[model samples]
Target: MTKLKGFGFKRYHLILLGFVTLASIATARIVQLHIYQHEFLSEQGDARSVRNIPISAHRGTITDRNGEPLAVSTPVVTLWANPKVLINQKSRWSELAKVLGESEKSLAERIEKNAQREFMYLERSMTPERGQAAQDLRIPGIHVREDFRRYYPAGEVTAHLVGITDIDEQGREGLELAYNEWLAGVPGKRQVLKNLRGDVIRDVQVLQNAKPGQSLALSIDLRLQYLAHRELRNALQEFKAKAGSLVIVDVKTGEILALVNHPTYNPNNRSTYSAEAIRNRALVDVFEPGSTVKPFTIAAALGTGRWQPQSTVDVGNGVMKVGRYTIRDVSRGGVLDLTNVLKKSSNVGVSKIALDIGAEPIYTMMQQVGFSTDTGLGFPGESLGYFPAYRRWGSAEIAAMSYGYGFSITAVQLAHAYAILGNNGQSSQLTFLQQEKQGPSIPIIEPDISHTVMEMLRSVVEDEGGGGVRARVPGYHVAGKSGTAKKQAASGGYTKDSYRSLFAGVGPVSEPRIAVAVVIDEPREGGFYGGVVAAPVFSRVMAGSLRLLNVRPDNLAQQVVKQGQVVRGGRS
Candidate 1:
């Protein structure tokens, strides 16, 4: 019995030793994996559950000089889905389509076609209410992402100036497109843990921080914009005109205060968007400026030292022959001084003056005043109106150009030119942004010569039987010119019935605070002359703008008398 017990003990001891050896080897294998190969294991684990997610940044806001919001971004929700997962949730698609305003069949087809795609946009830019309702369904693979949408508070009133953005919140036109880079924000990235259903479980770490877009302040004044829009709309409706545009600028700063177009589209609702409605006509469309160019013509003539504002020109029988074309005046002003020539809008007289000064000087003056060039507003599709090379001009071309016929110019260009004249022949570039410091003005013409032209334009408004008499403001000295040009046909000849009536001028001429330009296209019901169709718009807008700026009235005597009358009536 003693011998058997000892053998058993030895067998048991051998088994125990083998078990101890196996336990040590297993522990050593675990230590090797955890201490030396931990990085590889961790990477594999992360690959299965972690993801890099994009973080969207908010776009910038566009405001006016007064800090009024023009274009703003509002937070919204965008719904997306994994097509492969959504295709299986077919029964829930009808409810999803109803909320998205999409037909069930269409939504089903889109999901089936994009089944291979992990992510697809189910609905973009949904209101918070609609997004919540959609989320209530609790369907798998459906996701809601926070996003932004652009909103224009001023609506169609400032549409053309502020412009619109696309579905992805990208600027498409106007100031929006011009400063897109400055207004677009940069997206960011983050590391996150996702569940088996591809839902974000927890945020792990920030990979990159989002950079929000910077805000932009424009030079547009909301008050002036509304006034200009209202006046232009009224004119279009009253005259039964095809289209019209109005622009107002601050003469001292060279900043565009207001720019409005008729037949404008509501940026918020683009269902009826058309090329005509979307076009910024004041900056893009060019027409023969007619007699509006005559002021510049007279200025060019006076610069030569051979002619003065009082110089006489014989407009014989109100007709001047230039090649095959006959330049005729609206009235028979047989002989008139330079000022009278502009006052009456005498085609023959101005043509004779242009012929005397020669084309090169006129072209040079036009170029100096910023004609035939972009307005420097950096707007998209801006027209650099046609000013042909002086070397290519003939007597007829010069004669036609003298009365504002040969060359073409945009409405803003005409306003800019007049602003230069108003600014004492000092030329500065126009800006869509608020000017912190006034730019140095370059001398374009002699100050005395510009003043002389300004006085002559004032005569056109103040003088009886003048073309721009209707443009006269009650108590202010208004300096401006009128233009009526025949529209050129696409097939190559002038359209007889179609006309572009334009009036460009400066208000409170003694100090010249504001410059306004108005263009009425194809006025059928009312008279098509610039004096009749466009000057009144200029008068109302200029007067209103002058008052809005609180500019000290140059004609305070009239204002005082009017106030005195009110007091006297009260006393009585």
Candidate 2:
């Protein structure tokens, strides 16, 4: 009986001993976690407790010289989703799809397809009004992140100049693409503590102040740009033209005042536009500059002492044969002086003078005038327009070139060349920014010769030069030339249905403050001559630009001259 009682006690004691051993092992693990592995466990805890949210950076604003906003940033919300959590939530998706302006099937498919990710963008760039609706709904597992979208306030008016950016806020065209590095700023970050509700209770900044991008101020006057836009658009539509472009520059400063290209795109929402609409036609498109280049040939002759403004050759019968092609004037062959050659736009007259200058010197003169070089306006796909090196020449090249068709040039290039004539023949650079101290430059063409050309240009606006007469403004003397080039087809035939009309000129001829160039491409299935289609547009723009610059009227000069003549008569 004693042994049985002792055995039972021993068995109970062994069981209690086993329980103590298990308790001791558990305490060892607790110590390891609290002491030896404390840091690792703490990091694990923090990983699940803390959250990272990115802070967005806004791109800088682009403004005109007058401080008018051409482009700006507006705060908006973008819808996002955690794909794994959002898929199969039909009701929530249905509501979201309605707000996002998408069908339910697309929303469901987008989420289902991207379920492999924790982060996914459901919709991009929704308007503030619509985003606010999604925000109010507050669907679980859905989020709205703060972001910015760039807006062009002027819309299509300055589209080709300011350019546009893509969905990721990367600049892709014009000044935006050219100065992208300077325009895109550094992004910043922040950290915060939130109670499971994802509501911030304690916020701490993780980075220094976000730097805003530097402002870009262009040389463009908004008013002049608007005026040019209106006139060019109207001309393009009226003439039923395929496309057109215009450029205005300050001769002294070499600053571009206004540049307009038709068939322009709106940068605001560029969803369905072609590359053509986005192209800066003034800088990109090159066309044969017919007849308009004749003056340069004459100017080069005068500069080189090969001829004077009075230099003349009989423009025989108004027709000269060149390689089976007869270069003829708009009129019958007739004898004319230098100014008469310009006024009548006699191809034969200019061709004879070009022959005297010789093709080599003429090409060199045009090259030095900037026609051989690109305007370098920083636009994408800018062309130097081919000017055939002096080494490449033929008999007909000079004759054909004198009246303007053998060489190709962009509208901006024409403006720069005319600018040289206006600036007393010191051809210089062209600038897009008003703050730029640089200018277009070339060797001076004896100021006297330039004055002679200036006076001749005045005759263009007066009664003698009929084409330029239409280009004249009421009070300002204008000097300019006209061009009408036959458009060649891609299939190797000249398109009788097409012509590139052009008007290149200088304004307020007394002081010569503005230089302008306009081109009309394939106008209205009707007569497409630079003088008839483009010069009228130039007249309107020059009038607006001169008015904007407050250039003193020549009317005052006329009064003073008349008064002086009267006093001189009395003194005599």
Candidate 3:
């Protein structure tokens, strides 16, 4: 057939032409997929198989000065699920419940409750191994997220000082809240690959690196902390007191060696938390100092070169009238030297000294010793104990101020004041951070004056009729004062029965090493005197602390040689 021969094709040629047309169409589709639709398809695939996930940064560890762990962060995982997918896997719900320690019904209810939402936490803070076990079950939509749980190794013993963090690992109190920014590290991001089951197959790449928090080294000595906590707790129980606080400080460095509160709560357990139990009383709560301020009044007099340790004041009938306010003392009316004023805890004696010195010198001396201000700790909720201005002082006000009345002072403030006396009038700012070297100290008073005051304080514990007789250690000479202040009634005047017993002291009187303060609030059993309730705590805690710090004894029993035979008498 020659007709249309130019255009006509044989059967084999037609087949070959058909194959070429199909091949061309296939190549175009390949080009569309590899080039034109490449970006869209890649995005879709990544949506299902890749993800940008956040990596949780580890929280910092908090340790005592001796490197003992106080607070620590442990690695854990939070298990979550896509309820839409999980609800479909009803049969696997029991298995999930078994790992979660929940009943099957409970698991079902949880999943159903969150079914509309794509994400819900099945469990938080599960061990890594436990989380992995659940993840390996191959249940669809189950996911594991990295997290941290804070743990306090010292528990209630260090709770007040170390403080606590919330579920999200944010510091909430004490030193934790004060240095949160320094401790909490920045979280980072990373790209990861996943399979169809939502399980991470491999890490694709690190978009950002996670930064771990820095470790905190506190100034507290764990050993001393335990000792103080135990002694304070025991004192609270023995005295049937409402609450108590104790603080130990290094005289030379002003480092708070130990700070404890009787009503402290455990930082590890959230359920044990309460406002009353969690408050750091040593730094936060303030009370009238009572006889604790007597020494300062005497110190002010000594500064004027008008009084000496032997200077005498007549506390006639143990009562003095100042602007219709009667200042009375429990001691017998008599003439007492400056040293006896403290030893007897005579309110009248200190009042006379305060009246003679006027208000400015007493105010200046107290201010220089760190009263009416924060101890520079920057502790959360720290109180600047109220010390009225000298400009406002009347005769009654001055007399009241002399014996620790009409104002307030925190336990730590009282401790800091005593620490200056112990440190030879060198006032160092208090610190919770361990000091590598002695920080700069302000010279608060002349060395001779401080020395005189320290000796006077020593007599309060060492003399035969000293008020702080119970505070004396067997081998160490303790210099301290006792205070029994009346708590002001809510209406106006002070309550007759309610009292705050206090004892503040420094040890190894010859060369001071440590200063400690103890406060027992409202002792109902035994005596409410500071010498009775707080001084014993000081004695036991100071005695043990001195031995632990290897401080040599300054008041050891006198040894005498008699005919080549050694004889030991009572403590010097």
For all predicted structures, in order, the TM-scores are: 0.90, 0.90, 0.91
How much lDDT does each candidate structure score?
0.86, 0.79, 0.87
lDDT of 2 by residue, 1-572 (tens): 99999999999999999999899899999999999999999888756655566677788888887888887878877877777666646678788889888899888888888888877887788787887898777765577777788899999999999988887677888888888887876666766665443445576557544566666888888899999999999998888999999999888878888899999987886763578788888888888888778777877778778787777678777888877778787765367878878877888888878877788878877787777586767667788888886666676777887787767888899898888889888766677776646544666566788889878767765653355666767677778887788998999857877888888899888888989999999996546877778877888899888988899767443322222231110000
Please list the residue runs of candidate 2 whose C-alpha ends up more than 4 Å from where it truly belongs after superposition: 1-21, 103-106, 193-204, 436-444, 555-572
Clashing pairs for model 1 are: none
After TM-score superposition, the amount by which residue 475's alpha carbon in candidate 1 deviates from its true location, in angstroms, is 2.3
After superposition, the stretches of candidate 1 with alpha carbons farther than 4 Å from their true spots are: 1-38, 101-103, 556-572
| TM value for model 3 | 0.91
Quote the positional error of residue 186 for candidate 1 in Å: 1.6
What's the CA error at residue 374 for candidate 1, in Å? 2.8
* Alpha-carbon lDDT of model 3: 0.87
Q: What is the alpha-carbon lDDT of model 1 when measured against the actual structure?
A: 0.86
Count of backbone clashes, every candidate in sequence: 0, 14, 0
lDDT value for model 2: 0.79
Task: Estimate, for each residue in 1-572, the C-alpha lDDT of model 1 and write its tens digit.
Answer: 99999999999999999999999999998998899989999998888899887787888999999999999989888999988788889888898889889899999899999999999998888898888988898888888877889999999999988898898888898888998899989989999998877878898999999898989998899999999999999999999999998988888789999999988998988885789899999888888888888888888999999898778999879877778887777778878999888887888888888888899889999888888787778899999989899899999998887778778888899889999999999987799898889988889989999999999988888766777877767668889888888999999989989998899999788988889999999999857888888987988898888888887777655432232231110000
Determine which window of 10 residues in candidate 1 has minimal summed lDDT.
563-572
Candidate 2: worst-modelled 10 consecutive residues by lDDT: 563-572
Which residue pairs come into collision in candidate 3? none
RMSD after CA superposition, every candidate: 6.1, 5.7, 5.3
Q: Pick the candidate with the highest lDDT.
A: 3
